[model samples]
Target chain A: MGDYVFNQRHLLGLADYSAADIRHVLEQTRTFREILERPVPKVPTLRDKTIVNLFYENSTRTRISFELAQRRMGADVVNFSAATSSTKKGESLKDTIRNIGSMKIDMVVVRHESPGAAHFLTKCVPAAIINAGDGAHEHPTQALLDMYSLLVHFGRIEGLRVSIIGDITHSRVVRSNIIGLTKLGAKVTVCGPKTMMPPFVEELGVRVTYDLDEALRDCDAAMALRIQMERQDGALFPSLREYHERFGIRMRHLEQYPDFVILHPGPINRGVELQSEVADHPRALILDQVTNGLAVRMAVLYLLSGGSRV
Target chain B: MPSRLLHADDFDRTIRRFAQQFTEPYDDLSPLAIIGMQTRGVYIAKRIRDRIREFRGVEVPLGVLDITFYRDDFRSLDKVPTAKITEIPFDLDGLDIILVDDVLYTGRTVRAAMEALMSFGRPHRLRFCCMVDRGHRELPISADFVGITVPTYTTERVQVRLAELDGEDGVVVTEGA
Candidate 1:
């Protein structure tokens, strides 16, 4: 109705946020920003709201950021570790969510190692489902923050050239960022090894590339995708060294374009997809991305809750 | 709510007067160095910057800071969170920083903004400017430049809307819960 609600039960994916919706979220983020700046920063925006952080995957930044965002907005936050939950005891994902929903949770922020785990949980609970990270599928909030970071840097998203490098097949950040960036009118290029890069990525209306140098050229921003070793077992690439040599972004590689800004969704492997020098460089917005993660998540919660209020 | 109203010209003149009071001492301050706290502060800062440029042909740099994570009351609230973007193209180190806002009620927002601003860099001087300074100082803070001083009770809320953001320009005082 209101260009799709950023509500209590939002499923985390770029598909969930339309261009207008994204704009609305970003615009609403401004108000949340102001609220955050108050000495007594907690807003009663979600006074009685309860958010269940059902993380099946281990994440330091994502979980903590979401927790902080919720607390900042005046919502009650509950952290559910899947390792100790019924899932470890062989209970179904649906039953777990159902049992939790019975507790009257207003929303669920889920991060699972399996693809579409958040989607699965959505079916089991009426609570607003937000995908933190579901396997290799989508991390919508990560993409939103990335887009927010980029928009803040560039002033506008329309007609900008963005290159996403690394494990396109396994990186959920890539999938979400590609969808979100393209939707906001930015031209995106996915570059990595042929094995790691997804097939028919052009179907998403993005240019596919095996050459990192070619992809890096003339690009306004280059986002290096993290190579999840746990996900790769001789299927994607021959060796990590080979991937680093050809596709990895190093200081030498960055010398080709002095104006390009670099981005990486963290837990970065020093020499795998990106060099430490490039990651730590002033042009790198990786750490800023981490700081922005909290704010953007707060924005998501605010807009979703505010929409529900209307 | 007594239906308080001020004409657009009066608002513009107040802004002009506030701008004069705020910028008078910093005649040599580069226009490219001002930063605004986010939301309404940004709108007020933009107006001051534009008016300064229009009158003196000196365009100043403006940026917005989002202090969501830096606030003290974060843990007492909701867990489903949203974040805003913090955009400052240039460094604020040793530069004059004029933190702008629409209404100064309890001074808590300014305090949080100051905390957030410190993370970027220490400024040469930090000043506070506000559209309305409603008397209810929860902290020992006073605006360097104020457009108006309206005595308000604790149950009253002040709302400011700009044409650039809210499709209109006006201020409203409502009864708070």
Candidate 2:
């Protein structure tokens, strides 16, 4: 297994990848993680390739992380924002991508409001497509990075209990994590308010619960997802204060579960999803998630570009 | 058909000779370190280090480097180059680094190794050591400590099998069409 190559061409979701394929990516990510610690922190592996960051939705961490990873690998990057692009003039998705496709782009990192927006690009363009976040469908890179951070902290993921708490109904992170963690032999539990919890979450091979305390009771790590206020149309919970009082991860929870670590997928609500003190605690892996996200994205882009070219 | 160039005994003698060459130049082996390229080079480096410790009464730091990320031909490859552990535990600021590899062909691996080493820190000096220097120079790079220099066609294959990895210690050349 010295030359374990990632066989997938596109990273649309974690469901498309096998357990060995996911492990291969996580193992390769260790190299990129070390590269970031080097004196130069750059490589020319992707110098000849040109990648386009096509964002049809608003984002901060994922966008910057992908761009940094691309630049660090010495790839030429083109940024496409939906608000400023031809999509604003009512141009269709296929037509806009086809226009950009003429420029000979090698890959496209896309985040759109509609689910399966990334999968749509593969049929229209020859470039490999990486789904940053497509509505509430799946964010493979974020989940992969989350798993990477978990592996880094605990040294293994198999047979570990993980609790994912927050807006499960509208969280792409939870969906991807459940699929990825389960494939790697992890037992996952999803905890959120009944309104926020998806109807068919148990079908994805994770235990569902409405109580945050029960979720974090016997787990190795707890991932607190952002509430995603923008994605929620009607109020999932009654109020932000009530939600914080009910399900927010506070310092007491840390004291209660001393053996478990905390994780959040960025833009943490100060008092809603996580207490300010808990977010700044030593056990919190939010910052590490950001760092690992870059490495994971770099690994994904490198593997996808190297994917079985005929 | 493949023809054997060096059997197990010959391989041991060549490694001991390389260890002697490494120790003869320096008054003190304190500043010297050995960095082995991924798989085969790692075992050869370990043998040389063991020999130096047994005869010269000095221990040298050994580091492992995987140059998959630093390769120049990533786009041209049929599959993604896999990576191994690159662990340089000691500081590389002023160490005299000797890069060890099993075979030297186009010298592209050496080029990538040199670049990869510089990323850690500025070493005092860097040199290359290889068991087999098969002549095909795509880059202007050559091994300083060579076991055997063989003149061969670009289509030929030079195989180095170590007992640690391949269950045998031998060097063989196979004809290619």
Candidate 3:
């Protein structure tokens, strides 16, 4: 296929995409990875295109990653944090986005506190919408990047056993990864406490487990999510020490599986989901995930939004 | 529908003569860098580099440039081509560059190639070279080195096939819409 018929105008969730779509994204990302290795990594593919990062929540990492990806394609970016925006003045999401759309912005990468915020803007504005992360709905780009990191390390994602550890109820990253990784033919097991696990989470097509060690038995990879302290009201579990004892991935826990790689989406809750020692471990693909996250975003943003209209 | 312009023998002889004309004025090709446009241009560049090495007894630095991102007609295409890697391992600043392409019709490919080449760094000098210069002047651009020149109408297409890619080395003229 010489031409890229990615076929989708917006990337809302992985569930909306087919298996071929995900593979196409990963294949195109390989070429972009080569570009990243060159002396001058910047490509003028999207020059003169303006993209607005409309974030309703505080996110230093994802916002910066999307901005860097846009700059690599020579596109201009405007960051709009909710703390400094008119949304704090009680303006509606549509009203603010409609105003932004009036200025001829090409695409809007949105991170909203409510689920379906991206789909909400698709009906209101003419600009292309990319769901950075919506409430606990889906973070398609984050999961796609995680898949990229796994594909790079393991050379294949299909037929591999992957265990997602910790805070499954509140992690949008886990939701997105389950849909993508499963569609790519991976066996996924999500492990968390009863309180942190969402109701009927198995309906999302993954095995449920309360025990992390049991899930890690023969799993090729384990992704450790941060225990979102702010998302949890008081205490989802009995105590932090107890959670660390039962659920946290420590050095002793990893000694059982010799070939498993542990991954964590950053701003880590150091001694909670993973110990500081495990975070710094060589087998952990955490840092590589962060690095590949940029390339994956570039691939998605380029394929979906970097069109002729730009 | 199909007309052979240059077969494998002519292709080899033409590139050999091109190497002579290229290295004649300059005693030192150490400062020269050659880059080919994507797909077919890349294959032709490798063949030319091989011939140059045979004559000069030294390897010339080469790179591959994909101009898919820089094309002006990106939106007008029937299908948007996949983005290929634009790999320039060495820096381009203060180095003379020879850009190779398969066929030249409207000169849009050369225009896009020049824009892509400068993205790495400003070359000291840059020149275009093509295998066939089929005449249909939509833009004021010409190749510094050309293998053959054919004057044709806008309704005809100039297709270049390489043995490494298409299992044969030849040029053809085909009817276009």
For this target, which candidate reaches the highest DockQ against the unseen true structure? 2
How would you encode candidate 1's per-residue C-alpha lDDT over A29-95 as one tens digit per residue? Answer: 6655555554455655566678899988898899999999999867999999877777888987778
Alpha-carbon error at A30 in model 3, in Å?
2.5
How far is B18's C-alpha from truth in model 2 (Å)? 1.4
lDDT of 2 by residue, A56-137 (tens): 8999889999999999999999999998988889999899899999998899999998999999999999999999999989
After the best TM-score superposition of candidate 2, give how far the Cα of residue B41 lies from its true spot, in angstroms.
Answer: 0.9
lDDT of 1: 0.79
In candidate 2, position A298 carries an lDDT of 89
Per-residue error for A275 in candidate 2, Å, reads 1.2
TM-score of each model, in listed order: 0.68, 0.96, 0.92
- Candidate 3: the clashing residue pairs are none
Q: What is the RMSD, in Å, between candidate 3 and the native fold over all Cα?
A: 2.5
User: On DockQ, who's better, 1 or 2?
Assistant: 2
Q: Would you list the rank order by TM-score, best first? A: 2, 3, 1
lDDT of 1 at B68: 59
RMSD of each: 7.5, 1.8, 2.5
Fnat per candidate, as a fraction, reads: 0.08, 0.65, 0.39
Candidate number that wins on lDDT, 2 or 3: 2
